[model samples]
Target: MFRRTFWFTAGAAAGVWATTKVNRKLKQLTPESLAATAANKAIDAGHRLKDFAVDVRDGMAQREAELGDALGLNDQDAPELPPQRRIAAIENRTYPKYTYNRNEDH
Candidate 1:
């Protein structure tokens, strides 16, 4: 029984030492793996940027068509007034007011 217990303790110590050595090696190898991962991420970002640019161009074209219809202007016609100026020309303009101010006393 004593012999068996001694062997079991020794085996557990050896396993712990082997795991520590393997973990050290893995830590040493990780920086190169991280750099390669970053390079792959940059390549993916470039593809995403290209896709986003195309989406923005298509969205702008659709928005311009909708705005032209709403304002009774032809698609080819440039409006005499800018959008912000047109909004300001409308009646019953009221600025937003806060009901409560945290810093002010009631």
Candidate 2:
């Protein structure tokens, strides 16, 4: 009698555990859950891509400087406009605006 009861209790516990696992898996497979998982993965990929681009840019700049140094190039000789001069150039630009009058030549 004790052996039979022990086996039955074990079987019932196993069944409950299996059902709980299956239900959890089914919930994860639902459309909304799947969409959320995909969105999270996509966001992770975008961040990885942006990080890769920044790394590539920094590496390119470093390599260019190294090559310039090997070729005996001088970067300091290049002319650079000052901030005030640049701003003055931009401020000197003119734009014209026109208004139409209904009473004028129709």
**Which of the numbered candidates is closest to the native, going by highest lDDT?**
2
Pairs of residues at least 3 apart in sequence or in different chains that clash in candidate 1 = none
Measured by TM-score, the strongest candidate is: 2
lDDT of each candidate versus the true structure: 0.88, 0.92
List candidate 1 stretches off by more than 4 Å.
Answer: 1-31, 75-106
TM-score per model over all chains: 0.42, 0.68
Clash pairs, candidate 2, are none
lDDT of 2 by residue, 36-102 (tens): 9999999999999999999999999999999988876755576776666434446667789788888
State in Å the error of residue 95, model 1: 58
**Model 2: residues with Cα > 4 Å off, grouped in runs:** 79-106
Q: Tens digit of lDDT per residue, candidate 1, span 1-106?
A: 9999999999999999999999988875798877887889999999999999999999999999889889877745674775564345667889898698777875
Task: Give the range where candidate 1 is weakest over 10 consecutive residues by summed lDDT.
Answer: 79-88
